[model samples]
Target: IFCSQYMSWTRNYGVQGTIFPAPNFNPVADAQMLAGALQGFGCDKDTLVAVLTQRSTAQRLTIAEAYQSVLGRDLIGDLREKLSDHFKDVMVGLMYPPPSYDAHELWHAMKGAGTEENCLIDILASRTNGEIFQMREAYYLQYGSNLQEDIYSETSGHFRDTLMNLVQGTREEGYTDPAMAAQDAMVLWEACQQKTGEHKTMLQMILCNKSYQQLWLVFQEFQNISGQDIVDAINECYDGYFQELLVAIVLCVRDKPAYFAYRLYSAIHDFGFHNKTVIRILIARSEIDLMTIRKRYKERYGKSLFHDIKNFASGHYEKALLAICAGDAEDY
Candidate 1:
């Protein structure tokens, strides 16, 4: 996909001209836009699909209303008629009112007969902090069932628990007081140094529970008290997935870009790359923070992340991932 940059440039300048920026979403205006696109001259189905599917859920609703007012048609019903399964799925995902419903659907998919592991991985592992919270709410609202209960029934062991904890989305809002920040930092330092279960608990609290904004303040406090970067301490004491997880937390805490750079580096370096991990992270973060990941990759690795993936990975899966990483994968 990174190698395709040349092609992207060619498309930008040659035949395609420039891709139009997405319109500022207004439900009423959006209905007009959709009607115009549908009924007006030279409006492409692909363009309509892109615009309708890529907008946030709220924007989609507004556009839906607009679509009816302007075109006298149900946007979703029209979409179903014109688009096939894959595209329809993307559009429908966007059209759904609450994200929690989506989460609930994913949860049920995982628990239903013939479990969809990919859906589980995609939902549980990839959501933003805010999205995860919405999902928890959605699961409860849609099913009147605890998301955690479904997860426990469907998954086993520590990995299951980790996913549940993440979905639960509990975290401190912020640690503004310098004294409190220092105390949390001291606790983090002790945990990293000891590598005990207590350490994991504290690390999870700081990483998974706290907001990134708050964690950053906590990292500074850690540095102030310990005279060492939090990352260095974790690296020294922890090993394997435990270490990788903690490092991810710390990297996310200090610099998300740098953290992703590390992940990108891990994806391609050594004998065989962890393709699943690479694909999972890329897919999960692409919509949420991929632009930031691209920036971080350049700043930390001194080259495009896409370039490295192109150099290292092979085949169609590689191609799909590259397209995704390059920000050209069809929006869903």
Candidate 2:
């Protein structure tokens, strides 16, 4: 149900991020400004949003350190106490180191009653091997639990198996074999064609272990062999979270920024407004490919992410998200 059009823009994004290090940045000055903003009667929500959202994540961490050293106050803690609602959520998400943030989100997703399978699939499928490694380590350090084990416990059947395979983070990187792509595509087609028993293991092995580049090739080969898009085949073959995760991987392999752009659009329109999903994507991708995401959103949806967000959200929450988005559609 998602667009699979791989754009030329996805191939080359050398710093296509909306957020960047502020020119002439001074962490101490930013920390002090934040301190003053939060000092008096009530809090200066505007200054808090301005300083935190404008800075890069690394710069925000530095400001946090400075806030702790110079003022003996934790920046995140102060912000949490001062800000409220989704605005606070965005500010707090910014303060975390990326892996920590991912780990935190993962833990949050799986913690309570029903698990957030989409959140799990989103992070695990999109991250690189190194990023997955760091997130695993952070998950252990922060929560004192194995991420794979928790996910395995939370999920079951082939879905659990596929997630476990991705958790290994051993997908080949920067390498693709044309011959193997053809072979894997045949394997996938046969597995899908099988009518009896569970071919889920075979499908998961190929889908989860292949490098994204190789998977892209496999997808092309699959099309040539089966005369059907792999995504359509999966939709026809599989069901539930397993199918969703596999499609997500394909989408990311095809075009990560576009996958996230679709995700952003879904978050806005799917329910009333999925603030957590919106906050997570905006904060996580701000320094990665949000600019590309913005462009793709406009191309695919015929409107700017900023414009949709402005209409979906209000008050400080909207202001903070808008800042991270940098500007409207025309800015890109």
Candidate 3:
């Protein structure tokens, strides 16, 4: 039951009616607003050590500007003096331009004898549409080479094609119609029941091809006709790695944040922790939908995500993850 609406208000009024007055402000006031927020959050010299270290480079600049205006101090200089080790390194990395992040990731993957497929997957798959477009442009601008060409050279087959397609921003445009969505779901179910290659193809087509908004409608129609949630149906029908792959696609399509919440829960629920998965999911989604993930985590699990993460994991990694998940990743 999602309801969306756009609201508009006009400040001017004619005749005898009273007009709503606009709030007054100045540049100093704007600075105070940002500064007050950081101060209110207790983001002082010591706290900036953690904040700057954990956030991305773009995030640090915003904070630094705010700190300079409000506190009459330099955030980066303070952080340099107070922090050290891995934390300092992360903070310094966050200060680089976005191009630097992409180039650095690529450099790390290609620096040695071979390319890291996981790094390629993590970056290309997780970026938003606009971010990926910007990255493609930036990659060309920074390296004087085609980003897609580099990715193709590093990988092969359908997986490579899929990554490149995503990076190239070539997917179906958004579509929405209750009737067509129901038909698509029926077709999907029939293919799934038959255990044909069409099932996998359709799954990928719907999951990877459609916009999230359109897929949400399709998923709802699927639920109506199938009398079961898509996740449950996929879990029941598929097996082994195929099942995991299908489930990941469906979950990601359904609600990415919810998918992440489940992943976070899975990371620590079993006897031993899948630390890599935890770290990967946290880092990948930290700036994407992590606040939404926290909301979904609370709703689905009936517990504060930070509290659970603290209970399950330990040390600075846990703290960094929690801070990022707490909506401190970046201003953008």
Candidate 1 lDDT over residue span 36-123, tens digit each: 6655334455556546544544566777877777677898786666555333444444466556545645765766786555456545
Q: Tens-digit lDDT track for model 3 on 1-332? A: 01011001211111110111112313344344444434543434334434443444344556567768778976556545555554444444445455456655665565557866545654554455677777777777767877878877876655555566667665455656667777778866765677666666666566566676676887888888888888788777766544555566567666667777787787667636565455555544544456677778889999877787788765555556565566432221
lDDT of each: 0.61, 0.87, 0.58
> Ten-residue segment with the worst summed lDDT in candidate 1?
14-23
Residue-by-residue lDDT tens digits, candidate 2, 1-332: 11111112333545467776666788999999999999966988899888988887778989999999999988888888887888889989999988999999999999977898889988988998999999999999999999988988899977888889999999988789999999999989987899334567888888888888899899999999999999999899888998899899899999999999998999899967999899998988987888889989999999888889989999989988988988323452
Q: Which run of 10 residues does model 3 get worst, by summed lDDT?
A: 1-10
Q: Which residue pairs of candidate 1 clash?
A: 27-62, 31-66, 31-67, 100-138, 171-209
> How many clashes in each candidate?
5, 0, 2
Deviation of model 1 at 113, angstroms = 13
Which segments of candidate 3 are over 4 A away from where they belong? 1-59, 62-93, 96-127, 139-147, 150-158, 172-174, 194-199, 224-228, 236-246, 268-288, 311-319, 327-332
Give the Cα error of residue 29 in candidate 3, in Å. Answer: 19
Error of 2 at 178 (Å): 1.6
Cα deviation of 111, candidate 3, in Å: 7.5
| Better-scoring candidate (lDDT), 1 or 3 | 1
Which ranges in model 2 have alpha carbons more than 4 Å from their true place? 1-13, 195-198, 327-332
lDDT order, best first, reads 2, 1, 3
The better-scoring model by lDDT among 1 and 2 is 2
TM-scores of the candidates are 0.56, 0.93, 0.60
